[model samples]
Target: MQNALKELILQMADDALVLGHRNSEWTGIGPMLEEDLAFSSMAQDKIGHALALYTILHEHMGEPDPDKLGFMRKEEEYRCCQFVELPIGEYDFTLARHFLYDHAELIRYEMLVNCPFEPLAQMARKVRGELKYHVLHADTFLRELARGTEESKARMQAAIRYAWPYALGMFEITDADAQLAAAGAYAGEKERRSRWLSTVSSIINDAGLQVPEPDEAKAIYGGRKGYHSEYLKPLLDEMTEVVRLDPTAEW
Candidate 1:
């Protein structure tokens, strides 16, 4: 159970850290100034979430500092899902990632809200507060894009198509999954993924957008086992370059 708890915390910490790095790409390039500020706020939230998760990891797992865990890890050693490491190619693509991740995250954290592990349960409560606004931001875009110009709609659909597989992969299970479930870490992953798809699909359909092709549309894999797309390395390099340079330096 202790190992299970550590792995579970690592899962959250890695995902939040990588996603924050990817989201930060929008710092100066978000579609509009308001969105720029808004997405950057989201990025900050992700980083902050990672920080909180890391604090727990250190205290409970006897792990190294969070910076060492986050910055020094090899790509293949990081436990983050593929969805976060994906390239934020265009506005729609970035938003699609946000939409998919925000929805997945809502369910994920909601599950954690009742985790048998106290630290995770407490962290989930904190993360859920921030993610409430995140869901609104992403869902607002989802609605607008679904009803906007044909081009916006089409692009959003394409982004949805591209990310749906990785999005499913976000809920991919691991060895700890069973123990987590047995210990009520967050319900079983299979059940949780089912709920996730239904919630996300319902929102898309309600927005008048086409239902995303099902997770079975493709392999719907990776990131659970440390495998990531080609886009991951460069992103991590940039994100950790400073930290990498001065491993012994204090912030």
Candidate 2:
């Protein structure tokens, strides 16, 4: 059970860390000033969440310290979903990915709020609260862009279609899923995916956008098992550069 929980925690932490880095890349290059700040703030929240989760693993589960766990992992050792590792392409594409991703996150954390694991449950409650604003920000921008103009709608729809497969990969099941679910440690990805589809479909339909049919979408998987796109290697190199340069140095 401890091993299963550790795997879950590591995956969640990796997801947050990788996506936070991707979002932070937009700090100075967002479509506008407000958006730049918004993404940056959310990035900070995500990285903070990752740190907290890693701390739990260190203090309770005998894992490496947060810094080493976060910054020194091999590329194949990472368990982040491929969706978060993908580069933030364009404004519309990034917005679409953010909308899909955060809804899943919000639902996942909500499920974790009642988990049997006390430490994780407490952390979930706090993280879930922070995710509310992330959902709000993504929903607001998605709605406006989807309903704004013919071109905006077209671009958003295209972006959604392009990102849909990767978004589905966010729910890739793991061998430990059954054990975790049975133990009430988590509600499992299958349930979360169902709720996520319902929520995102409603938001998309209400905003006059189309939700890609699940039957027609192919999920891109394997990231949770350490397989990743070409992009992840470069991203990891950049992420760990400072730490790797001086492992003995302290902040």
The C-alpha TM-scores of every prediction are 0.95, 0.98
Candidate 2: regions farther than 4 A off: none
TM-score of 2: 0.98
lDDT of 2 by residue, 9-63 (tens): 8889999999999999998999999999999999999999999999999999998
lDDT of 1 by residue, 1-251 (tens): 78877877788888888888878878888789898899889989999889888888888779987777888888888888888887778999899889888877878888888877788898898888889999999899999998899999899888888888788788778888888788767676687678878888888888887776664546456677888888888987887788777777876
Candidate 1 scores a C-alpha RMSD against the true structure in Å of 1.4
Top candidate on lDDT is: 2
RMSD of each: 1.4, 1.0
Instruction: Spell out the clash pairs found in candidate 2.
Output: none
